[model samples]
Target: MKKLFILCVFLLAGCATQTPSKTPSACSEEQACTIGDQNTVETMQPLSFEEALSFFKEKKSGLLYFGFENCPWCQEALPILREEAKRQNVSIHSILTRDENNELLYTEEQKQEIIPYLQDYMSKNEEGELTLYVPLVVVVKDGKAIEGHVGTVDDHDAHARKMTEEEKQELQKKYEDMLAQLSS
Candidate 1:
């Protein structure tokens, strides 16, 4: 009995000391919200208009993510974006447009440059006005915008739904393929 007890304790200790895997899983809203700060992408600071233009001009191929801190979709999308970007070895730039309270954070000078760039990615309404959306991602290459995606590729009803591991893999693959196309 004494030997058995010791063995059990050793097994429990081994299990307890095992390291957790660093592989990312599909993130919940709670996890996503706190995973990283707003400057999680390659550019640690918010880019000025000239800086942003210069980045695209120099890099010629990279991912641009436009989001606000408080936007639910942005919160949900960012974690997935980070993981896939890292895996695919893509450089990502983040543009923050608002604060947690939905206050505008971009300067008018910044907006003057950013708005026109984003307008190129915007969808048109029947009235021919630009329809802008939050959590937008633009794939750029050779100083041209290749494609733009709006919103999270994962389920939008994130608060009420959780994706399975297979679903997460599929979403990651989709992003990988999209990025590959842009690079190619």
Candidate 2:
């Protein structure tokens, strides 16, 4: 009986000593509010605009996704991005383009600071002012933007509706090609 008890204790100890899960942290409350219940992507790590810009100034390599939770386009692209990141074994550093109040995520100074690096991907608005659109996935290597893809697909013009499976697959392929550029 004593030997059996010792064996049971050993089994319990072995179970208790198991390593932590590799899953990424759960979405923040704000993220949840933005993303809602359809979120399947768990690899998103939120970072400040300053930190994302530092990757450029410091010449670091990373995948940076700029989007807000309310954006249907962003919500659609996230799962694809997550899968591609997992497949490539890379971490995605995300930057919120807007807050819960629908305000800009960064200050004017921050916008100015990062504009030069992101100008190529930004679009011009009615006033000829540059606008940064959501779901902009940028792969930077040594701080240089190697590849950047904005939105899910070129054919899908509406954000109010979900993309077709074919479109999602196309987006997945786009992400795969983009993430393939990661050197570090």
Candidate 3:
């Protein structure tokens, strides 16, 4: 009986110490991909609120993109934003709601700080529902938001339509003009 008790204790201890597996995947089964067969972007995952804040502080004149890995609009906008960032030579900071492990990355306090900005920029749908959608792009200067866009610029319908090169260039120019105004 003593031997069996000792075995049970050892098993329980091992179970207690076991950590969750870290698999390398874009999204889990619970978090279905909404990108519609497109590849997801490889973005930096901030481990803590401080890290994300520091990124914003360091890149004072940049774009802060809030998104989820499983969001379809986010997936569509990322590549366009990447190209825009390169063309404009501007920094782009990605803030994710959850990590690849489906874990919450932002703390309550951090959400409080960020969500208001996203909320302020949200638009209403045809049904008059206040849409707090993902792929939110905020143009920031000195850690303050100057402008915010809820969806892909030029994809007004949010239907994930394929944008032509001309359309992409026009969108990039629009943001560049906005950033220029903020700088001035």
User: In model 2, how large is the Cα lDDT of residue 127?
Assistant: 90
CA lDDT of every candidate: 0.62, 0.78, 0.59
Give the range of the ten consecutive residues with the poorest summed lDDT in model 3.
29-38
* Cα RMSD (angstroms) for every candidate in the order listed: 7.5, 5.9, 12.7
Residue-wise C-alpha lDDT for candidate 1, range 59-123, written one tens digit per residue? 56677777776777776666677777755556566666665578775565655555556677677
Backbone collision count in every prediction?
A: 0, 0, 0
lDDT of 3 at 90: 50
TM-score for candidate 3, residues paired by index: 0.54
Model 1 misplaced stretches (Cα beyond 4 Å): 1-46, 53-59, 107-116, 124-131, 158-167
Which portions of model 3 show Cα errors greater than 4 Å? Answer: 1-50, 53-61, 101-104, 116-119, 123-132, 154-160, 164-170, 181-183
Q: In angstroms, how far off is 28's CA in candidate 3?
A: 16
What are the per-residue Cα lDDT tens digits for candidate 2 across 1-184? 9999999999999999976534332245233211212333335667788888888999998888898877888878887788777666667788888877789978888988888999998888899988888889998988988889888897786556789999999999988888877853
Residue-wise C-alpha lDDT for candidate 3, range 154-178, written one tens digit per residue:
5444454666677666766666665
After aligning candidate 3 to the native by TM-score, how far in Å is the CA of 106 from where it should be?
A: 2.5
Measured by lDDT, the strongest candidate is 2
Which is the better candidate, 2 or 3, if ranked by lDDT?
2
